[model samples]
Target: MKKITALIGSAQKKATYEAVREFERNLKSHTEIELEYVFLADYQIEFCRGCKLCFNQGEKFCPLHDDRDLIIDKLIHSDGVIFATPNYAFHVSASMKNLLDRTAFFLHRPYFFGKAFTSIVTQGIYGGNSIIKYLKNMGENLGYSTSKGCVLKTLEPVTKDVQKKNSLKIKKAAARFNKVLMRQTAPSPSFFRLMMFRMSRSSMKEMLNDEYYDYQYYRKNGWFESDYYYEVSLNPIKKMMGRIFDYIGHRMAGMN
Candidate 1:
């Protein structure tokens, strides 16, 4: 059975959780996917120190030893991830931001692949699209297949009409998610994703020391030679483009 981790970035289980729960319920109807819920507010994550330990040395070398590893482990083991948050000031909430900040190192050394991602955003009326877009971009960087996302208008008091609309939308989104999640094979990376892989891997291999965790990770994963993070067929033109990107990235890192 596929496991899906639903992480709520709200301070409390209020509107955001409500929207996530609705999504879970709808997803369940389509399939028997196991669901795990992570309330970020309950985790003891410390603020990112900007010391670059996680980026340069390794995540294990981070100064703060909170629930970061535990959370990451949960995510790594899951087949799919659902990030839910309340829109704040036209973006994700602080709780969600904290989680992202702590795991920012993954942008440099992505590990997750062949995983599905869907985001849920609850807002009073506006900015849900922006927050959902942010999470989708994160998923893309982490090697995940992302759905467009689910946005629900959650004004105060929660009217019946709103709930009805939310349920309908959630079910529609879940159907699309489930269909993609159940696919037997993974798709090849987009040209943009290939460029990212080329740039990041070349930069790390050229600039980082052997002892640096990011460099070691690249070696361990054989990313230096692999065309992309995951196995897939690539056309010749795309391969040439990736080569160009890698050469540029190496030159840029060499100059730094």
Candidate 2:
């Protein structure tokens, strides 16, 4: 069975938690999955201290001793991952933001390539859409093939109509997430992802050395020479675009 983990940020068993449960059920209707719910409140993830040790050296060098790696291990072992959070004060809950902040180095050295990712955001009113977008982008940066996530307006005293609507939204999002999870082949990189890889690799190659963890990681992964993160046939046009992006990256690196 495929392993899917939902990292839920809410401390309470409320809208966000319920939404993830509904999502799990809907996803299982498509295929059998071993779903695990990780309540962030149950873990001891310390707030990030803004020390760049994880960036400059390695994540192991990070000073705080906590469960960050344990959570990351769960993500690494799962076939799919979900970030579920409630919108608090127009943003993701503190727990969710703290997790993201602690793992910010992943943005520099992404490690979850080919994993399926999506988000579930429950909100009282107007901010859930933006939270979904933020989580999706973060997933992509972490190297997951992300499905566009959903936002459910879950104002208190949710009427039956609201529950029904949220269920439909969850169902649709689960279907999309399941489809990505069941794909037989690696997804081809989109043009934007292609550009991101080419530009980042080029800039790192030009500007950094072995002293930097990011540089060492790119070298170890052979990203400096690879056409993309994984081998896929790129059309001639994209190949040309990749080279152009490389040139632009080189120029940018030189200017810094």
Candidate 3:
């Protein structure tokens, strides 16, 4: 049985929570999964102080001590993760944003490779689509193979028609997520992701030293010489592109 964790940003059991519940049900129809819902509001999380300790040194050196690591532990143990939030003022709720802020170190040293990730955004009228896009990007930055997320326009006084529509959207999203979750091997990196890894690693090799955490992490992972994050056969064209990206990165590092 696969363990799936859904991080719900809302405090109340409302639209976003219900949407995730429906998603869980739909997912279970496809395969056996143990779904866990994590309500961020129930945990004690300190707002980030922008000290950059986690980025420069390590996450263990952060000043604030809270439940951040506990949440991260759940993610680490899960096969898939779902980021569900209600659109508050055209963005994710405070709880969701705070959680992401706390885990900002993942942007520098991503750790969720080979995991499945998707987003569920609930809104009254507009802006949920953009939030879905943002969360999808966030998942990719965290090294998850992300499925395109879904947004449900959940207005007040929920009618049967709206419920039906939301159910259909949730079902489709769940199916897509399940397929990615069941995959036995990691997917090949896209051209853009390949470029990002090559360029970033090349720049780190040229500009940064062992004093920086990123440089040390890259060196420890052997990213300085690897073609990509994992072993994969790249075509001749992509191999050439990778070299060009490396050259561009080296030039950029020199300019800085």
lDDT, candidates in the order shown: 0.87, 0.92, 0.92
Q: Could you tell which candidate, 1 or 3, scores higher by lDDT?
A: 3
> Per-residue alpha-carbon lDDT of model 2 for 205-254, expressed as tens digits?
88889999999988888889989987788889999999999999999999
Candidate 1 structure quality by residue, lDDT tens digits, 1-256? 8899998888878888877777888888888989988998898998888999888788888999889899999999999999888889998888788888999888887767778888989989887887878899998887788888889988888899988998888888888888778877888788888888899888887887788888888888888899988788889999899999999999999999
Which portions of model 1 show Cα errors greater than 4 Å?
A: none
lDDT, model 1? 0.87
TM-score of 1: 0.94
Report the Cα lDDT for candidate 2.
0.92
TM-score of each: 0.94, 0.98, 0.98
